[model samples]
Target chain A: MKNQAYRMALLYDFYGEMLTDRQKEFYDLYYNEDLSLTEIAENYHMSRQGVRDAIVRAEAVLTELEDKTGLIRRFQERQKELRQLQELASAAQAANADPVVGDYLRRIQGLCEQLKQE
Target chain B: MKNQAYRMALLYDFYGEMLTDRQKEFYDLYYNEDLSLTEIAENYHMSRQGVRDAIVRAEAVLTELEDKTGLIRRFQERQKELRQLQELASAAQAANADPVVGDYLRRIQGLCEQLKQE
Candidate 1:
């Protein structure tokens, strides 16, 4: 499940980068807005296959972009690392001998919070 | 760049949902592992276009999955909303009459931190 979430997150990031404006509209309608492909076709005044092709092309672009870049992959790795750090911090807090661990956790937490704000 | 990040994230998530084990291996080598299609084909003992088709089909699957689910899109939207909220809280804190805004920011910060751990 975690792997699935990470993959979806990366694909989402890649598609946004590589899709053209029309493709983005269709993608948003189909995925973000949960519109059917048939509905997207009607709204865009295109045939079902046409919409399908656009989506396909957009997907290829997204995949190619990911093949060239590792941004999302890196982000997922960082998130995993952050989780490990948080867990360590929690464990230390439970031990009650190292408030410094909690401080580190809080600092990492602040960085994550800033990332969300970005 | 932000939009690119979001798109890539979604595509990654979608691809993770739909790929088979073989496809996953190839995809990891090609994208996350930064191997070329030709290289992957050589490694997998497949024809060049066969590798191409696999990647293409995988891309289609990823796109279809995204079309059906909006997990990454929702995450991006939430991140954007959080940023806006953070900005609002920061501005309120600057106004000097509402330390409550600072507390709210800290609380939201904490939630974001927890999300990272997850």
Candidate 2:
């Protein structure tokens, strides 16, 4: 459930602008602010069911956008690859004593850091 | 002009599905298929100005999305970084005689190649 919530938050980050204003507000309150449906409904002067429906619609829209674009998936894959590359570089750096090889490994690690920090 | 067209094509690749069907068709015909505004207008029974307008609208929509997301810019930067990483790995591989250092460099090069192919 936690993983799924995090994933939905990321989807919102990428495609939330496409949501309707009410939907965006409800979804953000529920997901990011951890608001209860009753609380959100009271705040907006809406029924709990109405708030639930809007949040669900917003989720569907965000997810459909992600399905079409695959941008988030690609971003995650690249991040994983960078992590793996960094680990391998660190291992190689530790094993090698040659200053020349050390220099190259250092440069490679720098590149990996830059990629990951993005 | 050629570089700009290529960049527009890439923007289309990222966000074309969001455009209206007619906008997508006209943009692809003009940019991807190299059709002139006149040719596209004739094929679709649209005025030359109409075809031009649709293409321009599509371009504006794609640009707006890019401005909001910056995904293309990040992709280009990562690709450039990968190329540099590949070159450094290759140089290290060539300069080192240790099979172990060469092995690490070879693995690093493999990772770079995988990333570039994506």
RMSD of each: 13.5, 2.5
In model 1, the runs with Cα more than 4 Å from the true position are A1-118, B1-9, B97-101, B113-118
Badly placed stretches (over 4 Å) of model 2 are: A1-3, A20-22, B1-3
Strongest candidate by DockQ: 2
The complex in candidate 1 yields a DockQ of: 0.03
Tell me the TM-score of each prediction against the true structure: 0.44, 0.87
Expressed as tens digits, the lDDT of each residue in B6-99 for candidate 1 is 4544586545644677877776776677788889889889997888787667767776656754445656664564455445434433442334
Candidate 1, residues A1-118: lDDT per residue as tens digits? Answer: 1234345445766457445689778766766676777898898788998988887777676666566444466556645644553454344334433344334335544544555333
What is the model-wide C-alpha lDDT for candidate 1? Answer: 0.58
Q: Which whole-number lDDT from 0 to 100 does residue A80 have in model 2?
A: 90
Tell me the tens digit of each residue's lDDT in model 2 across B46-92.
89999888888888988887887787898889899999998878877
**Model 1: per-residue Cα lDDT at residue B51:** 82
The DockQ of predicted model 2 stands at 0.55
